[model samples]
Target: MYRGRRRVSPAVALLLASLGVLSGCTNAPPPPVVESTSSTPTSEPPTEPPKPKVVVAGIDELRGGFNPHVLADQSPVTDALSEIMLPSVFVPGEDGERVLNSTLMESAEVLEDTDEFTVRYRIRTGASWSDGPPIAAEDFVYLWEQLRRQPGVINPVGYRLISDVESRQGGKTVRVTFEKPYPGWKSLFDHLLPAHLLKDAPGGWSDTLDYGYPASGGPFAIRAFDLDRGEVVLMRNERYWGPPAESDRIVLRAADRSENLNALRSGNVQLGMFTADASTMEALRGLGEDIQLTTMPRPVTSTLLLRPNSPQLSDVRVRRAVLAALDRQALVEAGTGGGPAANLPAHAQVLAPSQPGYVPTEPSGEFADGPDPERVARLLTEAGYEHSGGKWIRDGAPLNLVIAAQFRETSYEAVANSVADQLNAQDISTTVVTPKGDELYRTMLATDPGVQDPPRSAGIDLAVAARPVSADSAATMAAQWGCPAVDPDTGRTSEFNMAGFCDQLLQPTIEAAVTGEVPFRRASERVEPTLWSGAVALPLYQEAQVLAVSREVSGVRDGAGFAGPFSSVGEWVGAPGESYDW
Candidate 1:
């Protein structure tokens, strides 16, 4: 007879199994039956919920100060965070072209295009920050007001031209009027910050984003930043209006090349972007097809700044002597660390190698492979310096200049050391100093104080630093060489200008270029020669970076020129993740 037997429920079966009642064969299981002891019902065993799916990306640097507009804070981590956390009006499309971010903005147009230009931006309806406030004109006004007058901003020229930022239509529509025609107006107002929270924050503009964002407008929100642990986690923003992030969490793990490779091997990290060197590239190539490598060129050009603010280097002839004493080819070879930048030796002072209309502006007086001994000696003599005991002496004091580079920045430190070595070999007294990057840029480079209320010393005589060149060429030129004005309130000079020194003769030309009254090419042509002859700085190479993606991670690929792999982080999928390692 074909008789069917009743089946026990899952919970009962689990309880029975725990009571030694489960049997493989149905016929055999009829031998014994388990009974409950009390009125309580049996329940299934507890199982853990699925772990949060996470994708960790390995990067080289992860210092805070993520305000995208700040110069000292412009790093790989900043760019990655801003692309995913902050909303932008225009972003790089699939083909690297400027495309309007339809998610945040409805439309942007040139309303008035006469001598005084005006741009109108309409924020999308219902587009609000992670907080309750709407993304509107106040954000634009905040960025402009800060960048235009901030001491250590990235590029303020475009923002400085703006005469006013007018809020219309209940603060949704923003009308920005430029004092002069700004052709690169589209580049302004990127990564709009939460003005309402940060405007009167205790830390002010410099410390607006030091810890984490107050509100998120993009797909992810900052969960935590544990600097000591070198890990920053971003979780999917519950209040995000756009499509949900593919991964539940994304982690930015700051590590070295070996540490990154180890994480990839352990399936801990799926993507890595590091400062490429010969050793790292060799090992990465040995991995065969396990990882994909892409070379990226950054916007900054690595240069050796001979700061004229230093009394020792104030004389142009001495500065020229220092430049002519080094073998720049050797500097490039050592500084590039046999990376992609070794081939792309920069020749322009104002424009980056990737920028449009960039031309090699290497001066006619450039140093050769081996420095010209005669030129070095003559320049030093002309600067009232005499070589005594194999060291240059001026006015009974040895001309000992200190060259500083940021500590932990391998490439820049290499360049500074190499420069010092070359100078020592050429009988030029030089000392090398490596300070923390924040101190080097914010405290050392930004200040050139005189004897006053808070007396300060000229910290670094010269610096091996990267000068960021943006879409606005005029702004770049002015930032490097423009004359800083005197501040009446502080009774001190403006620290906005890099080099802590500027040429009055080229100031008018820089201003004209910033205002768009003169063409970029013409202004740069006039300003570049003075910079080179004056020995203000010597451009070595552009910042070349690399991106590596593990095949284990899906949707990990290159973005475009100057676009990092994190641009599409919302779509990445990874393997099952374990609990947070902390």
Candidate 2:
């Protein structure tokens, strides 16, 4: 069975705000500093307050699972770890609208194209890995070459986006070319491994067991990892190339929500990360006035993937019937208590709101204010299905559905169970399958095509996956879907379309969004209709991560969750502050 990592509580967030302690960190301007009119007339300028010393801890710790070259479950652990290392590229921005961070390379640009493509990067002079080794262009060259030769290496997303790479002989830069115009190529820069560190990675780069332990070049390095004790401690990297981190040491201690909350109250851990279960949130009020909390929605969407290829699901009529049957509003309310800001099911595609080409689509069925069983029954009837012996049937078979649920997603499981009940009420038989974590990725996501449909290797029928895109660049369509390759000569397609869906209308629009040479606005107009109007995938609730710190911490600003758990790691500071009781 899969275990769940801790999640920050929203009720607690609301409660904290009610108490007027440091609450949610929003981008809103700080409540205007009230002016002391007469007293401030004296000629002295106001002095700034000292930075606060912030200590942050969470239930999840860095597991040294930071290598992006290999396939692994993405989580706050990996997200936090990525900031310290340099990708050949990085997505820099909020709400999945990230851009390339030029940590090691000064600039990168496309240099050549063919069925095979090539782009070049100019490395920043004097850039060195945390180990003090000079970074060379051949590092990426070697990295890509290894990826190409490895068979079990299933990072098709990167492979689909990148065609090939070449290390410039007698040069200070590296060039990579793609089979097609992969709009999301910029993500490669987010983290690039230092080739010198893992040149002999065992079983080749495809062997995750060997490749997993490769070197890191971030601001911190793994000091210790004790899984049985459930603690991973990280220490400052003295060889860091960027501005130094304020804390000399960072301890990642794993604990449950109750333990995390207790640790916070006792000051055993300066920060606590826990899911905002009802009890945890309610108890935060008693955690004292010195605690600070902030939360932001994650770049993820929970969804139900309908296998259109299934004998019972392929009909547009059936797809429409299923949509009509689900009470998404009720599902969100039951799962989150406070429904999403909008009643609309969360969009399934990974495009962020800030993405230049993002378009909002309407739900496909009778998306009303609430669930209506009569309306659901009516849709089923219109689809040529009839109620017989108190069950909906088509082609002499009962309408039965088996939904695969990933383990440890308690909220999602609740939602799935509720959905099954609703469908059964509508005379449809539905079953929920809860699978273990590894099996979920391999069977559900990799093979089933339901969790990650048309499957990343094949095409996905439907899936509810999280995808973050770069907001800085004009190209914002998620690489997972829009980056599908087209044969240069035959003009045929590659099986990378996550939806396994290709509409004449959507195909042209997706192509324009990815390969169009026009401005962002034009591309958005073309792409928006498909996303917002077609409602190919439903958008559900946005997720969030919360940070709680001691009053001593300062310079902590509001940021997206994925950038890092301590996203403001580069800016956090600590100084003397009033005692906890005071």
Best lDDT among the predictions, by candidate number:
1
List model 1 lDDT by residue over 335-448, tens digit each.
Answer: 878877776788888887876788898866576778777888998998888888988888899888899887777788899999998888889878889876566666678764
Q: Let me know the TM-score candidate 1 reaches against the reference structure.
A: 0.85
Q: Model 1: which ten-residue window has the lowest total lDDT?
A: 449-458
| Cα error, candidate 2, residue 451 (Å) | 18
Candidate 2 has an lDDT of 0.55
Model 2 lowest lDDT segment of ten: 573-582
* Local lDDT at 232 for model 2: 56
Assess every candidate by TM-score: 0.85, 0.72
Relative to the true structure, candidate 2 reaches a TM of 0.72
Candidate 2 residue-wise lDDT, 1-582, digit = tens: 123445659998788677665444555566778767675555545465543333445664334344544333445555555554554455446654554556656777866544555677776666667677767766776666554333222333444445556666444577777756665566554456667756774543433422133445666665666666666556666776767777645556777777788877877677655446445556665687888865544454555555454445666666666666777777665555442322323543545443344455443443766556777677678878888899898779887776655566666677678778777877788767766434554444433222433432322233433333443233334233343445443555543333334455545555555544554566555665555433345556655455677665666665652454455555655443322211
Candidate-wise lDDT, in order: 0.79, 0.55
